[model samples]
Target: MGDTAVGPTDLGPGRRQPLDPLDCGGLELDGALDLLAAGELTVTGRMTDASNATLYCEIAAGESSGRCVYKPIRGERALWDFPDGTLAARELAAYEVSAALGLGIVPPTIMRDGPFGPGMVQLWIDTDVTVDLVALTRSDDPQLRRIALFDAVINNADRKGGHLLPAPSGRVHGIDHGVTFHAEGKLRTLLWTWRGRRLSAEETALLRGLAEQLTGDLGRRLEPLLTVTELTALDARLDDLLDTGRFPLPSGDWPPIPWPPF
Candidate 1:
C-alpha cells in the first residue's frame, strides 16, 4: 500500500480534495430515519455495488424533504479498491471538485451527528432516471462528445455509460470517483474513443483556462486532498495531455469499464 496517512496538507479545494471535520459548516443532524421501517416515504431504491463504502437511505430533513442516501466515511474496509483502506475525506474532495467544475454529480451534505459516524447526506438519484450511456452513444449525439471531453480534462477513471445518470428533467450526472488521482498511473474506465478529434474552438479555450488555473490557486487549494507524490503525478499527467495536444488514450488492457454501477 501507498501512504494512507491523513495529514493537514492532504486537503484541497477541488471536488477530489479531502473533507475535514472542521469544514462542516454547522449542518446539524436531527435523527436517523429508517427508510426500511417507514414505507411512508416513496423511495425507489437499488443497491450500488461499485462503492466500497456502505450506503443507506434516510428522510431528507432539509428544504427537499424526501428520501436521501447517506454514506458514512469510516476506517479501511477489506474489499476497498485501495488496500490501505478508503478515506471519506478523499471521496468528499472529488465531490467538491465536481461541484466546482459545474459537473452534474451528487453533492454530499455534511452532517455533524448521525447514526453512522461523520458522513455525507445527499439527494437520492432515482434508478429509473439513469440511462446506459453505452446504449445511448450508439447514436450520434454531439453532447456525448462534449461530456467525454470534460471527463478527459478531469482525468476521471470511471466514465462508463452506466455512471451517467439521466434525470427526468433532462440532466445527466456522474458518480463514484474513489479511484481518481493516484501515485501510480491514472488507470480505469473507457471514455476516450475520440482521440485526435479537433476540440472545438470553445473546448480548446476551456482547456487553456483550466490548465492555467490548475497550476495556480486551484493547484495550491487541491494540495491538501492528495499526497506530494499523488499531486506530482497529477501535474505530470495534466502537462503531458495538454502539452502533447493529444486526447488521452486508455493506457492498458481490455474490458475497461468499472464494475457495479452505482
Candidate 2:
C-alpha cells in the first residue's frame, strides 16, 4: 500500500460479529448513517500515517455491522491555525455540505461517541487499489470536477491526491476532511485542473440550491459545528462563485496545493 494504506485485519474470535468484508458494497446512505450513529464501535486498528489518530473500527448494532474510521476529538493535535479539538466537527460539516450539494462525494459520516469518547465516524470506503492516483489527479474526470467545486465551497485546506478514493463501481469519494471549512482562503488541492473554467449549468443550479439551504436548514445544521464568522465566509465564497460564474483561481496568499501532493 502507498499513501492510501489500509491496516492489517485484526478480526479474531469473540469480536462481536464479523463486519462486512472490505469492498465497495455497503448499506444505502441512510442505513449507513444510522449504523454509524448507533453501532457499538470497537477499535480494530489504526492508520499510523495519519496526522491525527485515525482508528479503523468495527461497528455493530444487532445483526447490522460495518467498518468505519473513527477520529477521536481527544486524539486531535492542536493546529496553530485551526481551533483546538474541532477537527471531528469539521469533518462532519464537510459531509453535510457534500450531501446538501447532492454530490455524494463524501462517504456517510457522523459525529458520535466511540470507544475513545466523542469522534467522527465515517463509513470506510474501499477504493480500487489498481487506480493510479497521480494520473487520476491530472485527468479530466467529472467526478473529480464535482469534488473540486465542493472543495471550493468548503475552503478545504488539504485536498491531496491520497484523499481521492476511487471505488470499484467507478464512484470517486474523498476523505480526510478535518482541515476544512476555514474562514480564510485556504483551498489547496490537486483538482485544480478545472481552475477558472466556467461552471456547467447543472453545477450552477446545484450551487443556487445550496445557497438557499445554507440560509434555511443547512445553516442551522452547521451553526453548532462552525463559527459565525466561518459560516459568513462560506456564504461569501458561494456569492463569488455565482457572481463570477467560474471556478476560482488560486489566491496567492496561500500555497496553491498541499505539499506531498499525494
Candidate 3:
C-alpha cells in the first residue's frame, strides 16, 4: 500500500447515560469520548469479511453505552506491505487526518486497550442503507466529491463501495482505513469519475486551509503517529494538489482503482 496525525485522547462526558437509539446520533460530539477509557465491552460475533479479525461490540460506561467496531492489533493478519502491528494505529491516524482536513468523512475513532489487546474503536454509523453505490460513484454530489479528494490526500489503498456509508443527515462516513496512509503513491479507489476536473474555488480554499494547519497543530499531532518519511510525503502531496487545482489522473505507474469497485 501507499504510505499517513494526532488528535484528542478523549471525547464523551457529561454524566454518561444510556442513549436512545436515535438520540445518540444527534448528541453533541464535543468531548463525547473522554469516558471511553473506562467502558465495559462485549463482543457480538458479527464481523466483516476483511482479512483481520474485526468485531462488533457494545460498550457500557456508567449508564451509557453504544455499539462500536473494534479491530485489535494482535488480531491483524500479517500484510506484505504495511508494517506488522501498526495497522490499528494507522486507522486512528486516518481519522485524525480526516478531522484535520475538516472533511468529517471518517467517524469518531479512538485507539485504546481492548479485550484483544490494543486496537481501534469507532462509533458505529447508522447508515441509510438505501444509498446506491453505482449512482454515487458517478454523481457529482459535493459530499461524494469531497470524499474523492479525501481518498487521494490520504493515499488510501481501499475505497471500496461498502466503505462509503451514508447516514440520515446526508453525511457519508468512510471506514476500513487500516490499509491507508502509506509513504508511497498507492491511492487505489473507486473515485476517478472526476479525474482531470478542476476543483471548485471553495474546495481549493479548504485545501489551502488544511495545508496551513499541517504545519502547526495538525503536524504536531501527527508526528507521534507516523514516520517522518510519511509526513514528508503528505506535505508533498498537498503541494502537488494545490499546484494542480484539479482532480488527479490515474498514474500510469501504479494501480488506480481498488478491487471490487462495488
Supply every candidate's count of residue pairs whose N, Cα or C atoms clash at under 3 angstroms. Answer: 14, 0, 16
Backbone clash total, candidate 3: 16
lDDT of 3 by residue, 1-262 (tens): 1000122554222112222234234434443454344566677875767779899888776766777788888899998888998888778878777776656777767787777777787777787768786787777788788888988888888888888887767777788989887888888888888888998888788778777877887777677778898888888888899999998889887889887776
Tens digits of per-residue lDDT for model 2, 152-242? 9999999999999888777888899999989889999989999999999999998998898888867877898899999999999999999
Q: How do these models rank on TM-score, best leading?
A: 2, 3, 1
Best by TM-score: 2
Off-target runs (Cα >4 Å) in candidate 2 are: 1-24
Q: How well does model 3 score by local distance difference test?
A: 0.74
Worst 10 residues of 2 by lDDT: 1-10
